[model samples]
Target: MLDQTIKVELSTTKKQKPNADQLQFGKIFTDHMFIMDYTEGKGWHDPRIVPYQPITLDPSSVVFHYGQTVFEGLKAYVTKEGKVQLFRPEKNMERLNQSNDRMVIPKIDEQFALKALKQLVSIDKDWIPTAEGTSLYIRPFIIATQPFLGVAPSSQYKFMIIMSPVGAYYKEGLNPVKILVENEYVRTVKGGTGTAKTGGNYAASLKAQEISSQKGYSQVLWLDGIEHKYVEEVGSMNIFFKIDGKVVTPELSGSILPGITRDSIIQLLKYWNIPVEERKISIEEIYEAYDKGLLEEAFGTGTAAVISPVGELLWKDRKIVLNNGETGPLSKKLYDTLTGIQYGTVEDPFGWIVTVE
Candidate 1:
């Protein structure tokens, strides 16, 4: 219905090019945007692509104080043949709806939302970067807009999608990241909104992330809130430890965000006949494996970094370096296979990429 029905608002901008190498992440915006509004009675409506401009929200808006916001991060890439493709966007829409269902926000049709996004991309296809590892980063978010001070979910909301041209996660090359062991500052706990892609979770994490950054750590590896023994995740990304020739990651404990990249990696591992396990993994176990030289490699997976190799883990004063701060064999193999599939360089055995044009 959306594909043939609506005429997109084309608010073009004078193409002012930036130094591709100097592009800071999320610092610039494209010309146009995709927007849709939702009210109490009228569900999602007014879906359109407008000029990128400041959106007005009252200071007392619910999202300002209550933080009832949810978002999804994904990317669209134009292939070497100038064909635009999205990387399994249905997964993002499903996750976005799951976020809506949990937040009590009005559920809109996912197919329609996708159609709107594809049309927006088609209009702004020229903004997509043609450089290596660059992409059109898509951010779809919903925020509570009602002006009530009460504690309940707002009756009004806005669902909007924006695009930004982004350089690769590792512009300095594929370098290993140093993760700090955060004994405190638990990311999400049991019976909490950890599974939801809400803003509060991220807002709660910024302080810890800032502290870690100041202390020369690239990210933080969160521990289980109750015992602080089990490994949870790293920053916003999930962790995978290659132990004993098998892949082991933390099981979904109701506190961990089920990262789309993490799920995809597990599937690809299994498809390649590599041993993979999803279960409880403790800090002690990982440390022991590393000490015994059995820990082949450790990396965090997500949409942002895609795959970040961990060179050293900083637990207070202890520094556990993984073989001289270089990417491991398994890490390279996984990165190559996944990125190859994404960039249309490898055989997409599972048919994950969706062509946009």
Candidate 2:
């Protein structure tokens, strides 16, 4: 429906696709990619699909200097019936626009972007992996292209969609991970670019993540930037805790990224009539609950790892283990139900699945 004029050029020499069993995350790309350009006066134009290759940009591109970039990630699953489907892709597009607004980039038409995604996926549909715990990872991003040296918004930009066949995020697959509570380095602050899905945030987290990795931790549990007391997120994922028969997650207070998976799990919890609350949850409170024997379970949710159970939290030499460092019942159930709906094995009561064909 987007002008019906997108020019697509299939790749003549297709690259050898990776086997599903040996697939890694974001390493193997499909044969083709979707691209669109934008100018200051003339909005977004020249929608096209071409062979996947390197892009040429000037050395003075704003994206390289000022870091004006925003991206979104979603996956396309292959059902048992050999059908391709996207999970709440519109939500990703909506979030991308929100990021664009914050990054000073031009907003793209969501419907058009979705159509482009479907067309691109259809062209490389054979690249979709059907093996267990494997799906096609879709990355849609926008970058400032104006080759200007001044510190201002770019007048030119490029929007692109690329696909990769990826296996599970963790090699262990749905197992609990050890997280180090980060009280020193902060991921983001209030009135900052915390909610936006931009590159600078991830760039800023690399140091803490590297340190935590050296310390034998999977990820860093970031506390609030102001006082470094309240919980914000765990690595790149939003976190949740089960305490005394209730589910609690950090409320969206303009600093945390409103995760789609986080929202879905909250909805699922409420539908099951479980006591769920979205409010400020401090790390000390979680420690207090653990001290009082009320801490039931802990997990993190995101696009990559659907639900990653937190087995241990190490804060200042104090270690709090959840569920005996094993995956909890609630964590397992959520992962199973969400993945079942994604793979078309369970009935989609909430109408969250969208078929490609």
lDDT of 2 by residue, 16-46 (tens): 9887678988888999999999999999999
Ten residues in a row with the worst lDDT in model 1? 1-10
lDDT of 1 by residue, 247-356 (tens): 99999989999899999999999998999999999998988898898888899999987899999998767889885778888788888788778888888888899888
Candidate 1 lDDT at 317 equals 77
After TM-score superposition, the amount by which residue 259's alpha carbon in candidate 2 deviates from its true location, in angstroms, is: 0.6
Clashing pairs in 2: none
TM-score between model 1 and native: 0.96
Off by over 4 Å in 2: 170-173
The worst-scoring run of ten residues by lDDT in candidate 2 lies at 166-175
